[model samples]
Target chain A: MEKRVTFRGWMLPLLLILPQVVISAVFFFYPAGQAIWQSLFIQDPFGLSARFVGIDNFTFLLSDPFYRASFVTTAVFSVLVTLCSMVPALFLAVLADRLIKGSGVYRTLLIWPYAVAPAVAGVLWLFMFNTRVGIISWYLGTLGYDWNYVLNGGEAMGLVVVASSWGRISYNFLFFFAALQAVPRSVIEAAAIDGARFWRRFFTIVLPLLSPTTFFLLVVNVVYAFFETFGVIHTITAGGPQQSTTILVYKVYADGFVGQDLGSSSAQSVILLLVVGLLTVIQFKFIEKRVHY
Target chain B: MRKSLIGALLASATVLSPLAAYAETEVQFWHAFTGRLGELVKAQVEEFNNSQSDYVVVESHKGNYSETLNAGIAGFRAREQPHILMVFEVGTATMMSAKGATKPVYEVMAESGATFDPNAYIGSVKGYYTSTDGEMLSLPFNSSTPVLWVNRDAFEAAGVDPDTDLSTWQKVGETLTALKAGGEECPLVTAWQSWIHLENFSAYHDVPFASKHNGFAGLDTELMLNGEAQVKHLSAMGEWARDGKFIYTGRRNEGGANFRSGECALFTESSAGYAGIKAEAEFDFDVRPLPYWDGVGNAPQNTIIGGASLWVLEGHDAEEYKGVGEFLAYLSSSDVQAKWHQDTGYLPITAEAGEATRAAGFYDENPGTDIAVIQMTAKEPTANSKGLRLGSFDQIRGIIDEELEAIWAGDKSAQEAMDSAKERGDTLLRRFETANN
Candidate 1:
C-alpha cells in the first residue's frame, strides 16, 4: 500500500507531464525564444548585421499597410471560416445522431475529407475550381454564375471560405458527433416522453450538453483557420486576383523569407501569436464558462 | 615456438605496410533543382568525385527557389548551413547584405588560386551578380528569361492564324479576344505574375521596375509598379479576367500544367519551361520572344532573367573551398555550359559557350532559342533596364500579386491596386532599410 501510494505521488506528475515538458522545450519554447531573440536584431546571411532595433520592428509593422491588411484578412478569415465550418458540422452531427439506418456510412463519408493533407487538399480544390476544366466551374456555368473567382472579390473570398471549410467540417463534425453520442440517452428519452419535440429536445438538452465540445472545436478551428490555411491560400490564390486572400501567416512568410525582412516578418508573427493567444484566453474565460463540462 | 612464429609474421606485415596520409574534406551544396535538373547536378558531382580523391561533395535539394532560400535561412539560424547554396535572382540583395554569412565568389577563387576569370562570363549575366564595383559575388547558373509559349494546335483549333504576330501586348490582347470569341475559354494564362508582368514588363519597356537601379543603389528605393504604363497594362489584364480571357492560377508556374496539356494557346512562362514543354508537350508548340507594350516605348527593349544561381556559403575548410572552386570551374566550362544551356533552355553564362552554341548551329536549328539572349542584350542595360535589387523582393512580389489579383477581380482598379501595393511594399522597404542599416 505504501509503495503504491509513493509511486502515485512521485511518478504521476512525471508520467503526465514528462512528454509535454520535453516537447514544449524542444519544439515550442526553443523556436519561440529564438524567434524573439532574432527579432531583436537584423540578420543578413553575409554574416548577421544585427543592430539592437528593440521594438522598432513592432512599431514599423504597425505603420505598414500590408501588415495591417494581413491582420484584417486573418481576423476576417478566422471568424468566417470558423462560423462556416461549425454551422454545417453541427447540423450534420445532429442529423447523424438522429439517424437509425446507414448513419455509420454517412458519418464515414462526411469524415473522409479530414484524412487529406492540406497540401493535397489545396491541389484538389485548385483543380475543382480551375477555370478551364474544374468540376465546380461546369456546375457554376450551368447555374449561370460566371464562376470567375479570379475576377470577383466576393467569389474569391467565398471560394477560400468554402475550400477551407471542406477539410475543417469533418474535424468539427467528429467532435460534435462524439459529444452528441455522450449525451444521456435516458434524459433525451425522458424529455421526449414529456412532450418535448425534436427542436425542443435538441435546444434544451442536446445543444447545451454538447456546448463543451463546440467551444473546444471553435477555438481549434479558429487557430486552424488562421495558421494552417496559408498553404491553401498560397496554392490557390497566392493572396490575389489582388491581395484579397493574403492572410497573416502568408504575410509573415513573404516578409521574412521572401522579403528578407526578418524584423517585419517577426513583427507580423508576434502580432499573430498575440491575437491567437488572446482569442484562446477569451475562449477559456467566456465561452468555456457556459460549457456543460 | 607458436608465439615466436606469430611475432615474426606481424613484424613482416608492419614493415610492408604504407601509411595513410590524408582525410577527405566534405562540402555541402544546397540546390533548388529537382527531377531532371536534380539528376544533372548529381551526375556532375559524381563526375567530380570520380575525377579526384581528396574531397567529397554532398548535394541536397533544399526545396524550390523560395523554399531553398528559406531552408538556407533556417539552416543558418541552426548553424547547420551548407557550404554552397542556390539563390534565385530576386534574392541578390538579401545575400549581399548577409556580409559575414557569405564569402564572395571572387575572394574565394582568389584565395583558392583557381583559374577564375569573371570576363569569361557574358556581360549581362555577370553584371547582375557583380557588386557595385563590378566584382562578381555569385556565379550565374541556370539563368533564363521569360518567353511566350504558343500552342499551335490550340491556335488552329480556334481557327485563328497559327503564325499570328504576337509581338505586342495589344496584339496578344486582340488575339485573346478572338480566341475567346471563337469559343476558346482558356486562351491566355501566365506563370510568375510579378516576374513576367511587372519585372520583365518594366525592363522590356525600358522603364524601371523599382527606382535606383531597381534598388541595387540603396535600400531607399520604392516600387514603381504604380506607374502610368504599369497601371494601363494591369487594367487591360483586369479587363481580360472579367471576360474570362485571362485565368490567374496560383503562383509558381501553376499554369504549367494547363499549357502543357495543350489547352492554352499562349503562355508567358520562364524559358526553362522549354525543357518540360519539349518532354511533355505532345502537340506542336513553339517558343517566341516575350511580347511587350508597343505603346509604352518606341518598341520593346529587353527581358530580365529568371531561374537561379549558385552562391558560395561561408564556414568551410580550405581544401573544401578548393573542391568548390574546381566544381564551379567545371560547371562553367564551355562544353558543360553549352550543353546545359541547350538542354534546359537557360542562358549560356559565358560568351564562349553562347558563341559555341551559335557556331554549332543549335540556335539556327531550334528557332526562338536566341530570343531570350537577344531580348536581354538588345541594348546596353540602363539603370532602369538593369535588374531590381530590392531587399525582400519576394515579399514585395507577393504584395504586387495580391494587388494585381484585386485588379483582376475588379474589386479595385489597376491604379488603386498598384497604389496599395506600393504603400504596402514601401513599408517593408523602409523596415528593411532600417534593419540593414
Candidate 2:
C-alpha cells in the first residue's frame, strides 16, 4: 500500500510532462521520421507523386564510392578537429586557473570567436586564406611556402582543422573553465599538502574532477565537429583541391540543396542521422558513467 | 480675380496629391545582386518608383544566388514568399517544374495588358527561360556569358603581350607558364569552375552538357562530363595546379577577388564580373572570348549564361499580381533595361534595349562589355549550345566541384575524377527521373 501511494504521488509530474513530450515528438521526432520516410521514396521538386522503394536508396548509396568516401572523410575530420580543439581547450582552462591576475580578461578574449556567425566566420577565414591579398598568405609567401590551400590537399585539410579548432576553442574553453572553477579549493590544497606536485595534481585530482565536463564536451564537440565544421569547409575549401574535405554534412547540403535531388538528399540525411545517433548513444553509454559527480 | 476660390482649390489639391502617391501598391523583390550591382539594382528600383504611381517596387538583397534561392524556398514553405525571386540559370528547371507554384511571365504580362514581345529578347538568353511551346516563363534580368578577363597591367609587368591571341587554352597555358616562370605567382585563375569548365566546355565544343536536350526535353538526362575531351582538359588543368601555374580557389566565384586584386594576369570569370572588376580593379583589364581547347572539336562555339532571371511566384492576391506585373513591365522597359545593362554589365534583355545601349555608345566606350552579347548571339545556338535544363543542377555542380577539386589536388586523376562525378551525378539524375517522371 505504501509502494502504490509512492507511485501514485509521482504520476502527476509525468502527466504534466506529456505536453513537452508531444511537442518534442512533433518538432524533432516527426521531422526525423519524415526524413526517413522520404529517404525510402523517390521525390521530385514538385513534391508530387512518390513511389516507395524498399532499401533501394540505402543499397544504392552503399555502392556509391562518393558517399563512402564522404563518410570516411567526416569521421577523420571530426576526430582530428575534436582532438585538436578539446586538448588545447583543457590546457588553456587549466592554465587560466593558475593565473594570479587578469584571468577574467583572458577568459573574455578566449570566448570572442564564439560570438561570430558561422557564415561570417567562413568569410573571414576565406579572406585570410585567399592567395592574392590575404595577410596570412602574404606572410607565408614572404617566408617562401606558397601557402595555397587550393592546390594542396594536405594543406587544405590542415587549414580547415586550424580554422575549425580556432573557433571551437572558445566553446570548449567556456565549459572547461566553468568546470575548473567549480573544483573544490580544499581538495586541491589537500592534494598539494600530500606532496602531489603541480602536474601530478592536475592529472590525478583535477582531471578526474573535470571528467564530467570533459565527457559532456566530448559528445558536444563530436556533434559540432560533424555538423558545424561543414560550414567552415563549405566556406573555406568547399571539399575541393580534389575533394579532400567533402565531409558528410557538406555532401548532404551539396546533394540536397544544390543537386535538388530531394529523394537522394533525404536518403543521405537519414544515413547521417543514423550514424551520428549511433555514435552519440555509444559515447553516452561508455563515457557518461565515468563521471564521479 | 476669385482669390478666395483659388486659395481653397490650391489647399485641397496639395492634400490629394500626397494621398495619390501613397495609394500605389508595394511589390517586394528579393535578389542576389550586391556590391556595385546591388547599387545599380537599387537605383533602377528607385527610378521606377519615382516614375510610377500604380506600384512602388521594393528590392531586398537576399544574399548570393544559392542563398537567395534557399531563402525563397523557406519563405514559400512559410507562406511569406516575395512576389518576384531572382533565380540563377541552373535553378530554372527547379522553379519551372514547381507546378501551381510560379506565375508564368507571359500570363502576368497579358493580364496587365503590358506590351511584351518574346521575339524582342536575344535568342540565347530567352531560350533557356521559355517552355517547349515557346512561352516566356521568367524575365531575364542579368544574363552573362563566361569570358577571359586579362589584366593588361599584370601582363605588361610580366612582359607578356596582353593582346597576343589568347584564343586557345593551349596558348593560355603556355602564356601562364611564361608569366609564372617570370616570377608572377597567380598567373591564371578562374571563377565558377563547373560552369566555365564543364558546362561551357561542352557548349564550346558543340557537345552536350547533358542528354535529352540537356534535360529540357525530359528528366532522364545523364551527365556527359566524363567524356574523353573533358577529362583531357581537366587533366591539363590539374597539371597546371600542380605546377602552381593555375591558382585554384573555392568554387563559386572564389577567384573573383584574385582577378579584382590584380594578382592574376588572366582570369576566366563570368561576364557579369565586369561590374565588380570595373569598380575595384586598380589596373587595366579587358574581357575576351573564353579560350578554346584546340584538340576539342569545334572549340569556342559559344559560352553559356551565368546570371539570374526574375520569376513570379504564385498564390498572391489579384492586387499583388497586378503589382508584380507592373514591376516586371517597369523592369523590361527599354530605358530601364538599357540603364541596368550599362550599370551592372548584365546583358539587356531586349534587342531594343541593347540597341539603345549601343546608340548611347556605352559598349564602345567600355571596350569589353559587349563581348558577352556578341559571343552569345554570334550565331543561333545549336541544341548543344542552348543552356542546360537539368533538375538538381546546383547539387550536380557541387559534386563536380568536389571531383574537380580532387583532380586539382592530385588525389584523383582527371579521368578518375570525371568518372566519379558522372557516376555520382547520375545517382541524382536517376532519383530526379524516378521522382519527376
Q: List TM-score per model, in order.
A: 0.88, 0.90
DockQ of every model listed? 0.45, 0.47
Candidate 1 is graded, for docking, as acceptable
Worst 10 residues of 1 chain B by lDDT: B13-22
Candidate whose lDDT is highest:
2
* A1-293: candidate 2 lDDT, tens digit per residue: 45554445778989989999999999989988888888888766545457888778889878887679878888888889999999999999989988989999999999998888676787797788777668999999999887877767778888888788887889999999999999999998998999999999999999999988888889898999888877788788777766678888887787666665566777888888889899999988887878878
lDDT of 1 by residue, A1-293 (tens): 45553454768878878999999999989888777876776655433666777887787777655557767877788889999999999999999988999999999999999988876787898889887689989898999977877656567777888888889999999989898999989999999999999999999898888888888888899999988987777777767655667788887876676666666566677778888899899989988878888
lDDT score, candidate 1, position A170: 96
- The docking quality of candidate 2, as DockQ, is 0.47
| Candidate 1 DockQ, CA atoms | 0.45
- B1-437 per-residue lDDT for model 1 (tens digits): 13343235433543443321136666668889889888888777777777777766777676688889887877675566777889999888888877877889998888877787889987778888999999989988888889999999888888999899998888999999999988897999999988988888888887777888789788899888888888888989989988889987755687999999987888999988888999999998988889878778534876778777788887767878887888787778888899888988899889989899999999989888888888888788777776878886777787777677677667888899888888878876776776677
Instruction: In model 1, state the lDDT of residue B426.
Output: 82
TM-score, chain B, each candidate: 0.93, 0.92
Report the C-alpha lDDT of model 2 over B1-437, residue by residue, as the tens digit. 13343234433543453333546775768899777778888887877777767886667787889888877776665566678999999899888878677899999888877677778888888898999999999999888888889999988888888887898988988998889877888888889899999998888888877888788788888888888888888889999988989888777787888889888898998887887898899998888888888968777687778788999988777887887887787777889888888877788879999999999989779998998888888877888888999877887887888788878777889999888888878877777667666
